[model samples]
Target chain A: MRRDRIATDSGRDVTVVSRNGAASARDAAAFSTRWSYARKRQLFLGALAAPALVYVLAVAVGPMVQGFLYSFDNYNLIRPGSRHFVGLDNYIALWRDPTARSAVINTFLFTFGAVTIEFVLGLGVALLMWRDDWFNRIALGLLLVPATVTPLVVGLVFKALLNPEYGMIGYALAESGLSGPRGLLAEPQRALATLVAIDAWEWTPLMALILLAGLKSLPIDILEAAAVDGATAPQRFRLVILPLLMPAAFLALILRMMDAFRVFDIIFVSTSGGPADATNTLMIYGVKQGLEFFNIGAASAVSTVIVVCILIMAAAFIAVLKPARNRHA
Target chain B: MPDRARLSLLARRFAICVVLVIALAPVVWLFSIAYKPTSDIFASPPTLLFSPTWDNFSSVFRYFNLGRLLESSLIIAIGSTALSLLIGVPAGYALARSTSPRAIWLAYFFLIIRTVPPIATLIPFYLLMRDIGLLGTWWAVIILNTALNSAFVVWMMFAFFRAAPASIEEAAMTDGCTDFGAFIQVALPTVVPGLIASAIFCVMFSWNDFLYAMFLTKADTKTISVALLSAYGTKDISWGTLGALAHFSTLPIVVMMIALNRYFVQGLTQGVH
Candidate 1:
């Protein structure tokens, strides 16, 4: 009778109905069998997810909350006994702090400079390698080398190459009449620009790869239609391809911008934010405060600021890009 | 016009060649320096032609105990990858199956964790590990890396599992398999490629980590990256040895990239998509 009811409800052939009805009924029965069974499935799925949730809570979220609280306290690792609540003094000090202000400015400059150049160059390369050919494939493979090398190691390699006297790059640049004696990294005026170049080199391939994927998956019919309308390659690319590529481009921008804002490993090994703080981005400033100065409260405040800045950037990107995403859907 | 188009194509190819050379030159120079004899490393204009020496490799191993550092790095990376997979795969599967608003929020929570700078977490993590007396241990780095990598793992595998059809697991359940059994037996096999890709990524992230390893570990548990930084700091600059050590540290990941090129590209592109 239940099978008949299912067959009638589903409105299928009788033979097919019997098989599916049994299967569907079995599934329903499985869920219906003791509340314990339904609850068991829920428990099992929840249990499966529990470990990651617990781990994230313990490690990521817990540290963030603790860091926020620490920002309000005058806690120094070295002088643990002197720890006391300061309540926004650290944040207030940030307004007057020259070094902190410089770090924030430098971070913005680096993020914008690096990500912008990376996107432009990455798009160029992606377009160059748009065709699927042996040469392009090989080029793409070789490109991954820089992107895969550890950032710390990349910093060391560049530092060695830029070592003023005997360094390959510094020697070449000096011989070419490019800047003064201390080399690019040491020159206060040029240090940040050089760092931006290094960052662009390291990450542009990632941008290219992401964009290439976007280009590959672009609607061929649309491009061909544009071409059929007597559009030149450049016109077609500008009119059709660029708009289609915006979502990927924006995604690449967001990822690279967040990373650029948090840039540390390279700067740490190469400049250590010097040539007299010329390269002291926010991460470097925060690390210097917490680790070198042992001023936990100030470092936490810097961290809070960095987090807030990242959130603002992310929100802005989402706000701008979400509509494009929705329209496509 | 056809001639002009062909000329443009040639120009594009030439430009790409220049870009590739620029991209690969520094790495090639590092390798060249690593293989050169010590005296040749300081030679004016840097000699490209020389009898390569294993002395740098031997010296690094002798002076730095490269084996122990490699061991520490491997232990931490593998431990983190394993733990991440253990915790993250199930969560990914759950996220894939779930349609609840809570699940959507949970996904955002994972994304936010990944997006936040690691340094922001480092202060509290450093203090927390110090207070718990876990600082400078393999366990400390391992746990921290697990925390970092698991978020990524969950994010990557969440997409993977979502893309996979749910019908197989449903069929398995109809065949009298328990919910857990269906997941283990049916769903897991289907996403093996994704599992491998995510594992490779987790290992790379952990192995390449510098900030956490720098802050968390001391002498006994120091990873290769920290060791490389210290080698740079020693009084007499051994360019050859530094290059050799850098090469040694990067070799595993380089090999992985080459071997798993397809999967790596897929994983990266898929994440963005």
Candidate 2:
């Protein structure tokens, strides 16, 4: 009888038999109309999302996946016919190859060094610029000019300035005998550090901006309550402010870390991973292998390693931050 | 003011001045070089006081085909920005308004896409472009840039739209506006700042990008960023030519940044949330 009633829902208007049956049919009809309305909405939303989804999957993900696959093969563009599967040889060779090994280590050093200095300096700048004033506002706008200039150009600017023979700073430093016999970039010991300084110069303002945003977003009353509770300025900053600023700090650090790990343009133009490969980084190595040497297999391997390292680092950040976030929540 | 407070304020201002000088000096030096004569550009002491000349600027324009490089850059930046906004803004709206449990996750997925290292995609993309016969064309760079930029736009606009009120769109729907009409007429107007911010970001990133432009473009299609590299690598290491080219490469973006910084700050703050 229930099955017959359900089947009759399709043609209930024509097949109304009793008052109870007619009432059931009316409810079913209403539910069906509502269901169709939701379905239509879902369809409309899905239509809107489809283009981007397709494009990303096709253009971005497709190449990345192919690159990953290429890592597992003896892929060489120059000798395309010679290509074949080579399981973990490329990965193994990265460890065996001294240049590749240095690239990985140098990338870590660069990421950590640049991000650390940027964060520290950025936080200081943010604190100084915290007050809503015209001076700070204009200063911030001017400060961001270096960050706006292409990183490639920033490297060139420094390269020109740091030329020991003709550069203003470099010539002075060389003449004073403050730097090594060679200029800053020419000295392997000083090159990476110099690069870090350059990176900080380019990126620290942006960091400050992000941290400033976070600082501004903190609730004023909460801060005042902390102050009224007899917290000193330093105590308040350490206890109340630092905790609140973590999310923005995390964003800043992660963004910087990701970019710094792939420090290409600056290092490429400045040193080209030279001074005895002191500044060799993953990106510089990968580009040299893939583009310059046409060693696709080795290049793809480095690329894969980089992606893996980034994922691991990102995961580590989330894991570290997750507990604090949960506690706050 | 009290002496102690006055002292602190002066010290703070002094420190800020120091920071500003450090930040602006390198850029100032680069800009100043564009006006310096060739001989003075390579001056051993790097003399500060020299008669300015437009010779370097004229030489860069004459030799490097400055007009063509800037045109390519403008087209690539504007092209990618326009295309990405077109595809991304609507999708961002849909994601923002959707009722599905997975909508937020999809938005984050787009955010993560922006972090994918260029190396991971560059090689295969090179081959893909070559196979498609678009290897050296602006379209090749545009296509790759659009993919990345549109994903960013999607994520950014998602945040913008979510922050925008849904009540107005619902009211529009109740007032007989179609769903698309509500989005276009009522909802879109509220996110104009977001649109501008996203456009600015796209232009800046695509404009500053040298790697993709370097790898994908032929001589005629190279961007100013790429040209900046070749200028540095010239046989004579023409600092004057580089300085002049740097003006083209960095000035427009810098100017845009200063002009639109308010939107940048607003957009960044909103997006991070």
Candidate 3:
């Protein structure tokens, strides 16, 4: 009824539904507007969403579906798929292989370690800078420089700076009480940890920035009230800030963890999965096996695992964000 | 004391200065190495007062075709940025204006695609490149990069386009301009900041990217970042020369960022709003 009324009123033309038997024309007019408004909003949302749909289909859905199809059979360079189904052999071997196992472990360790450290350090830095001064502004600009640099370039810089002989960091650390030649990349136990540190160094600023933004946008009244009530700094952070900041913190975690787990640029730049596979992340291993070694099946298996992980994380983030969005709304 | 807040402010100022110094220290170390004598680099207690020299910088150009390497990096970075802008800007405008449910969904999908880790597809990407025989070509670099970065560009530009009033474009359309012409003439200028931000981000990511550059290229096509990685293995890395290469390679990016710090700041804050 509302749709028809809106259509008639707008001169766009429509089929009118008259409630002549019981309802008055005034009520009918209101009813028409109610339905038409809903339709217009629907139309608005639909139009607002169209290009994004096309882009996703073209870039994302197309690629993954293509990648998935390629995974099932041996899509070799020369053979280009003889078009035979190999079943779950790829999945099976991925579970069995020692290199695969190591890759899995490294990926997990990298993700967990890098995200944790980056978050903590990021949070710490964010709090320290939260006082809001000229210094904060300057620090904000200067600090993001590292985060802004390409990860590959960072790896390159670290490669030089961590060199055993003349690498500035190696030289300094050795003189100042550290062991081995370029232990960050060279030492087995420390390589992953070092990568975590490097990841932290690079991405923590991003976390800080995001958290800082969240901090600013937060209601100042809460903090002021807490302070007026004689709440300690820790208490204030615990009760008020933490609750409010949860969404951003979680968002940052999801982001950093996603990137860290699949970290390739820095590892590639620095170690190349060195010291007998200490730094061989899943993504790196997949690339090595698939692209470098031309083992398409293995690579696909690895990619599938990674995609699953991403989907899981993304789902969790969405789940987390919904409540936050509601609260804001 | 209630006045302690003032004291805290002073302390915070001091702390910031300290952090800034610490951050600058490592980068400064790079600059110092590029100037220092090789013997002085590992000199006992490492002399901080060594006189600066141009030898390292000179050796970089002489020893490696550093100029060509820079060109390669620039080609890859600039080409990717340009390509991303071309596709992303239009997609953003269309998504912004057209009340198409399908398009909005695609843009969100693009956002997810943009955010997904590129490392996951390294192998497939390699194979794809090899088969196309574009593995070592600039086209390969640009295509992969544009693909990887365009999603980000679209997301950024979409939001920027949203900030622009649809009425402005429509008004232009009603007057004399075509739809495309209105977007091009009016909407494009309005979204300059967003475009600048996206371009900078693309350049930085592409310039600093190592994995694709490493996997995709051979000697003839190596980017600066890749070239730096290979520096050590190239007939034994002479500290002076390698340091020089690193120094020069780092300069262009630094200069670009420092010059456009406002864009960098704007880019970070834009999405959150």
Specify the highest-TM-score model's number.
Answer: 2
Candidate 1, residue A65: CA error in Å? 0.9
Best by lDDT: 2
Q: Mind giving the per-residue lDDT tens digits that candidate 1 earns over A90-189? A: 9999879998899999999999999999999999999999999888887888888888888998998898788766788887887777967778999998
Candidate 2 C-alpha lDDT tens digits along A61-92: 99989999999899888899999999999999
**Once model 2 is optimally superposed onto the true structure by TM-score, how far is the C-alpha of residue A279 displaced, in angstroms?**
0.5
Tens-place lDDT per residue, model 2, B179-245, is: 7889899999999999999999999999999999999999999998888888766675478888888
Stretches > 4 Å off in candidate 3: A1-63, A74-84, A159-184, A326-329, B1-3, B97-104, B119-122, B163-182
Place model 1 in a CAPRI quality band.
medium
List fnat, each candidate.
Answer: 0.65, 0.74, 0.25
- What is the model-wide C-alpha lDDT for candidate 1? 0.85
Off by over 4 Å in 1: A1-42, A316-329, B1-10
Candidate ranking under TM-score, highest first, comes to 2, 1, 3
Cα lDDT tens digits for candidate 3, A150-187: 56656766776776566667677766658474545788
Query: Could you list the CA RMSD of all candidates, in the order they appear?
Result: 4.8, 5.1, 4.7
Per-prediction TM-score, chain B alone: 0.92, 0.95, 0.91
